[model samples]
Target chain A: GESVGLHLPTLSVQEGDNSIINCAYSNSASDYFIWYKQESGKGPQFIIDIRSNMDKRQGQRVTVLLNKTVKHLSLQIAATQPGDSAVYFCAENRNNDMRFGAGTRLTVKP
Target chain B: GAGVSQTPSNKVTEKGKYVELRCDPISGHTALYWYRQSLGQGPEFLIYFQGTGAADDSGLPNDRFFAVRPEGSVSTLKIQRTERGDSAVYLCASSLNPGGHETQYFGPGTRLLVL
Candidate 1:
């Protein structure tokens, strides 16, 4: 079955440093990709998204890079803060059905 | 202005019991979605609704799981003969349109425990 997966399960970064999370997807037909952040006991919050046609999309302190040929996607957070500590997930949309990755826990140290 | 909202923030049920989870989508949004997230995992797509009808139900695990959106605003997910494996956080999201590229706003989610 086609799935989205993350390269690491946990990441720790110091405050004010940059953090990057990587994801690999197996479905080639997926056209849309999204990043979500889930805090403890809460649902996923939309971070950013990018389409297959675009290689990169930037948000406030957040950036999403997509590599269609490599079936890879990444989320970069600048000046990591303690509030940024949470589980991050990447999802791919195929035929309006979105498939999500297992998720990577990001821990920001003060 | 308001995002999606779910009812009964938490639910605990015994095996063989039936339960219903409710979701109130954002005002004027025409698309709704249901997902399940287990421990240490991302939300798994369960179903999607466009307006008053279900547009995609392929993610439903089995017949015991059912959902309905009668008024195109509030949707309900029903689980029958619940098992312990059914325990998870059920999330609801809504989007302005029914497409893969549209942004979907999510709710806090309903936590269910089958005991």
Candidate 2:
């Protein structure tokens, strides 16, 4: 896979701290949203997802918050680790159509 | 179970050339998708297939890009008269089904470079 987020904005976080990545979706009709993590040389992997009916969803150490009014979504990673260093993406889906946002680069430092 | 697999992990072609990229989806997965990713950007959806039929292809940039999944498992994305802008990592993903927004498992994409 291509290495993404080379020139995108980056967020640096210390290990053991929490990191938040945000995204603004384009479609108001989008009902399903998903967060993905892509490490260098690997394809995007599913992290967490939320639907318009729900404001929040939690996975192991990750949480997804959806604000439908503003079309905003965010992923919160608690106790971030070096293994979490990667580019994060938010995607919106409606009627089987999914659109991804430009990713945010997360660099976790020890 | 084997994950999605793509062939020719890397490909470099000349402008105006034609190329084909292959994808073998996970066994028994009924939903398949194609996406193109450029540097600094997220993977853009290119096409989606349900069974052996293309369910959606609105994401395809133009007619120059075409895909086929006749057997409902193996897919091939074909590009004609390639341009520099067409160079990117082509990713393939598959899920159990299309509804309910099932998680899509992706393969290490095919890196295409048009010189």
- DockQ of all models, two decimals each: 0.57, 0.63
TM-score of chain A of each: 0.92, 0.93
Share of native interface contacts recovered by each model: 0.73, 0.75
Candidate number achieving the greatest DockQ relative to the actual structure: 2
For candidate 2, the TM-score is 0.95
lDDT of each: 0.92, 0.91
Summarize candidate 1's per-residue lDDT along A1-110 as a digit string, tens digits.
12344343889999999999999987999999999999998888999999999999999999999999999999999999999999899999976799988888899999
Interface CA RMSD, all predictions: 3.3, 2.0
User: For all candidates listed, what's the TM-score of chain B alone?
Assistant: 0.98, 0.97
Off by over 4 Å in 2: A1-6
Q: Given candidate 1, what's the lDDT at residue B6? A: 96
Winner by lDDT: 1
Model 2 / residue A21 / CA error / Å: 0.9
